[model samples]
Target: MTAFIFNNLNDMQANINRNKLFVASCLSLLVTSLSFGIRAGILGTLGTQFNLSASELASIAATAFWGFPLAVVIGGMVVDAIGMKKLLVIAFLFHLAGIVLTIFAGGFWTLFLSTLLIGIANGTVEAACNPLVATLYPDNKTTKLNHFHLWFPGGIFIGTLIVFLFEKMGIGWQIQVAIMLIPTVIYGYLFSKLDFPVTERVASGVSTAEMYKSVGTPLFVFMFICMFGTAITELFTGQWVGVLLNNVTDNAILILTITTGVMVVGRGLAEPIVHRFSPQGVLLISAILAAIGIYMMSTVTGSMLYFAALIFGIGVCYFWPTMLGFVAENIPKSGALGLNLMGGAGMFAVSIYTLFMGGFYDRLIAEKLPEGASMEAYRTAAAGTTEAAKYAEAQLTAGPDVLKATAIIPVILTVAFAGLVFYMRNKKKPQLAGA
Candidate 1:
């Protein structure tokens, strides 16, 4: 283990074949990115079928986030000890099982468990492959990482559209979920034939103790703390959009489409945007735009609100992958451990918020409806109503308030991230000058 850890990094780096690595990395990313969209689309379909109470549905969505922290921790050792090829195989199998379980998940526990498993797989994918991308292009970490992540939002766009197709065909949600396994199976085959990078932990010869210490800096902590916020902003919006728009319209599908469309646009543009400003500058800007857009999403109404959703999407576009890319670029020597920590922190942040806020947002949104009104009634009443209609002649209204109230989190997150970017910048300046 020590020899593997202390191996000459420069020599080992030369052994890395860039073309095979890129193809394998992109394939891995395609699976990881596509999985998120599948989860989102499946949950959305579940919402329509189950007619779950706002909190109940939100709880299911939150299940996926729970696996984030643990996956990162496990991935750190797994990638270095076992290698990326094996880890990718493990991720694919776990993801395939999660999809299968979701297809058969009948009741609340089953659905929640399946989603949780999927989240775990997703978390592992991020933990292992994110670092792999960094290792594959150590000299161009941010640019390559951003390009690798383009598929995340891009995958969501495809998944979203796929759901629209499935729904139109009156196919069961289970069938739609099962369809994801096709890609998982195919990617497993592709990855099996390829060589992957040894984790930085193994390749760099860094001691575990030193590995932990190096990343324990204030800058790393501060950056991840902000990343936590970005994770919440990204996951929360995708998770809650169906419920958020429930009272606004019966067309849950349409609402999801619009929201996800914004996500696609934002993510598709992420690489260029990161190149233009550096990941840090782009991130700060993302935070500010996300805050304002979330505020508008919550408070505003009509065609105007749709525009706000787009803005919110733009803000979140580069947030998640960019943060991962930043750490990957800056801390190439830490290898999987460093990358896993970032992924873990981000996912853990999402899980915490989802678990707590699922119920909280439900109560907050419910509080605005007329007293004694059932959620069904409130949803029914709010459909087709303007913001003014929400206030006057309220049979039971919930649209504007829920969307608006949810903004509170993003607003707080944006402020916190702004400070984080400032600190990271100052810390890096000294280091760069010293170098």
Candidate 2:
């Protein structure tokens, strides 16, 4: 009886652990989405309240995206040595501290600093959970990865919806921002109670030299560049959509809603498609479609904008997860650190462009607006001969050109992907000759 109960208890414990970790992973992503949604909701308010220029707001955005790479890259390097649970705990502390700081921020520098903290938390969560999920479901990496990432979009949907509801009820943006704490608290509790396992690198007894050797190769570096391009293309485009469109349409959140919804379903059903097309085929097709979709977004507006979002959503939906999945499959030796570095590369690209786009918008408007227009013409200005009005007018006109600038990124990606596909096709020729 004792032996039988012990066996049954062990089986029960095994089932409980996987499910708990999955939920914790989802909640971690949920915190990220919540932070994103709340930040988007208040972006305009922050700009007007603090008398912030477009570039200043962009700095905050840059700070947030930049923090991801710092934490993820470092977390990746140490995750195997320190274990996933400690990284997760650090993320939790950052989330708690960052959210509170963001809520109390009254100026540009303060907001930037707080957001940087949150970004660290966000990156650490992703770095730790990604390898955790991959380690748990080794053979089903792509399918499970798709499922794991589904929560990012899913949390986006929930968060944006919550803010939308609060807007209808006349709640302040601060409260909307604070609502993120609910999930943050829940995830913290779950993580506290959960037990984390060693990374696959440790379990498989892979050496430190072996891991370093794999990531140091030429092929890996080239792929890292491709990952950087693809990441910037997807992230920068999404961040700009809110800023440019918020004033143009009151229903701006709906665009985010539609795009994220499509992404959820697309990722949910990724398994069969991944099997049929192969990771390389999927990436090539994704790059092509993303270019076409981003072009349409640059050129379209109104109800038709939703259609454009759908196409763009489906195009970029697979880029993030599939990139991680490919590295996991192709470079298993590099392990969790490799995964973190790949993701960090993407976020680093995002941070750079966020700052650039921010500065670009400020400079673009300044070049046209009368010098005094910067100080006076804002929020409530009307269409007339006033300097503020002219500045406002200039901003409205500047939107399209900014988007056109973004379109260049995906075009570069399309060409890069085609070349990669060609190289992949001929990958074994040299090795075969040596044989």
Candidate 1, residues 316-410, lDDT tens digits: the string is: 87877777777766654455777778778877777767666666655665566567656565543444665335433331234455445556666
Show how many residue pairs clash in every candidate, following the order shown: 4, 0
Decoy 1 TM-score against native: 0.84
Model 2, TM vs. native? 0.90
Q: What tens digits encode model 2's per-residue C-alpha lDDT throughout 1-435? A: 545653454454464488789888888988987787667756777887787878788888888788999999999999998989999999999999999998898798889999999999999998899999987787778778888888877777777787788879988777887888888999889988988877767666578888888798786787788888788777777666677766445677777777778878988999999988877778888887777777776677778778877888888888888888878877778889889999999999889988888778777766777665543455335546576566666666566567778777778877876776777776642110001
Per-prediction TM-score, please?
0.84, 0.90
Q: Pick the candidate with the highest TM-score.
A: 2
Tell me model 2's lDDT, rounded to 2 decimals.
0.79
Q: All candidates' lDDT scores?
A: 0.67, 0.79
What are the runs in model 1 whose C-alpha is more than 4 Å off? Answer: 1-17, 42-44, 48-51, 250-272, 331-333, 365-400, 420-435
Instruction: Count steric clashes of candidate 1.
Output: 4
